[model samples]
Target: MASFPTETHRFQSFDGVELAWTEMGPGNEGARPVVLIHGYFSTAEVNWIKYGHAAKLATKGLRVIMPDLRGHGQSAKPHDPASYPRDVLMQDGLALIAHLGLADYDLGGYSLGARTIVRMLANGAAPRRVVLAGMGLDGLTHTQGRGRYFHRVLTNLGSFERGTPEWLTEAFLKTTKGDPEALLRILDTFVDTPRDAIAAIAQPTLVVSGVEDFDNGQAHEVADLIPNGTYREIPGNHMSAVTRPELGDAIADFLAA
Candidate 1:
């Protein structure tokens, strides 16, 4: 697949933290906009652009806005624990949308990004549509479970035996050159979303997940919870699924429709 042109820009969030976001596809007036947020410890480049997801969406003639979450990628990584208040990521996403002047755009996120989208919706973000990828009901209601697991992984960096889940996560972290201190603080910022909040989401939502991915629970359950939600299963697991073209294809098709 041909690479799509991308532009990276920075903006200040609600707390004056500088965050970075990338843009793909046509910049012309009246182009439909879609904001794609990356997962935990992952950047917009790794989760979206690196695997051609952004490009695929761009090919559909949609403006793809990919943001590198705070403490990841080109965004400022503050080590201060106080800087990462509850729902800071959601606030950052909201700020990015405002900064870009996007009012009628679509929103999507994978894993942590997906959870963030749920928080945004519960907090009254009015996206025209939403795509929750690699997320499930447990992910929203039982966030502390995953947060604790990641805390262990981050707190105990090099002690995990080879072939263990922690080892694999640590390996991926190294690839991303993530800051454990900042990310550890990020883990504290996670907040659970009630089932009532999930059901209250009014926008049409697509809950798409990898067939083998259960890292965040069952995607179909998430779909079932939303008033206007549908589910789709694609190839691969949580890690491998993002590398598949099918992930991008599903998202582009949904947003275009």
Candidate 2:
């Protein structure tokens, strides 16, 4: 059974790319809203709804909005690398929030999604409260495994040796049904969002990570970077953390507080 009964839609990105999104729970007036961004190669259904996070929030009377970033899932998969300008990926997210007319709301995302949220903060989009999950300070400094290895995987494809990070990344991307060519170019444009700028984010923030997850380096340190950030540890690692109930529970409790 699906975690949340979602109403999905397709919208134009800031660059006119057709993007996809899904909504669960109430309208703006019915309850508070949260915009959740999914990680690279992941759709809204995989990241939020599949793991019960969105449904849990919806049950708490909060509206959850999940968008599949461009070049992933149902969104446009333009194979051209130039289609993704360095400054526009995060803008796609901000554009969605503005389209929804959400002046006051919470926001969150996981992995690449979290990185995008940090860039959004750096770009001056302030939500009432924010959640940065499965991401760390190292990630915002530059694109590490996300760009280099994912790019390698695409370039080599089946040539990658089994058990390597590139191999694993290719498998994961394939599992998620990601667009290979679009992702290859996404590597060219993945934002190395500035760390000093991220520190300027003053909104109350929650940085959640699995105890074993360090894909972007130290989780606690990333939380410390924000003036008002708090770190919460859940069980599991990067790939498995989102599937755990504790992750959703922690998020629900923190947002409610």
Candidate 3:
């Protein structure tokens, strides 16, 4: 069994939206920070902290910051899709980085968070190193496709406790609290980056994927693209993959390398 610190705090993005984020580990003396971004519909504390990841990484002598993206966790939910654009997400991330005055750090993201990292790197906000789990830039194509697609699929699937696993359903319920129409509009605004985005990321990158869930073969493609990229496969489906401790170990090792 694993547990995490309950301490919580709030920060604001450039747009004035109040964002909720959690920081764990020691006071981060001279250690480079590791920013962890979660997938859509998931919060920082529940996703990353519950698995003892923050504590584990902290013990490894690193600082960790996990933030709840807009419309998730305790952050403000803006009804405007324009506000949630991919660049906006990137800015939100960089804003956190700049606010903390961290000159250099490592970055990691799962699912939607990974996609955001891709956008961040594409926009020239590259970190020293990056670890992307449960996603690849290729999946961003779907994100760029009609945002209405997410609205259609999710709305049509409306609250299916059956067939869907308990944990995933629970995860969905947390971030879908906004007006469905608003979320749809927001998602619609997202346009996935073309292959050029991957080509632009010059940092050392590590791509991780689960046994299940293959989205556009982006993970492998990403590994093949970056000058210094490596690929690793973890056991379990997309939802269960990142929650495992072994996955954290692999990430810690990669960052150390």
- Using TM-score as the measure, the top candidate is 1
- How much lDDT does each candidate structure score? 0.92, 0.84, 0.73
Residue-wise C-alpha lDDT for candidate 1, range 128-229, written one tens digit per residue:
999999997899999998888999999899999999889999999999999999999999899999999999998999999999999988999999989899
- State the local distance difference test value for candidate 2: 0.84
lDDT score for residue 217 of model 3: 47
User: lDDT by residue for model 2 over 87-181, one digit each (tens)?
Assistant: 56788988998888889899899998898888888887889999999997888887765577566677788888899867887788888998888
| Runs of candidate 1 exceeding 4 Å displacement | none
Model 2: pairs clashing at backbone N, Cα or C within 3 Å? none
TM per prediction: 0.98, 0.94, 0.86
lDDT of 3: 0.73
Name the runs in model 3 displaced over 4 angstroms.
Answer: 1-6, 145-149, 157-161, 164-171, 174-182, 216-218
How good is model 3 by TM-score?
Answer: 0.86
Candidate with more favorable, higher TM-score: 1 or 2: 1
Which has the better TM-score: candidate 2, or candidate 3? 2
Evaluation by lDDT, superior candidate among 1 and 3: 1
Task: Rank candidates, lDDT, best first.
Answer: 1, 2, 3
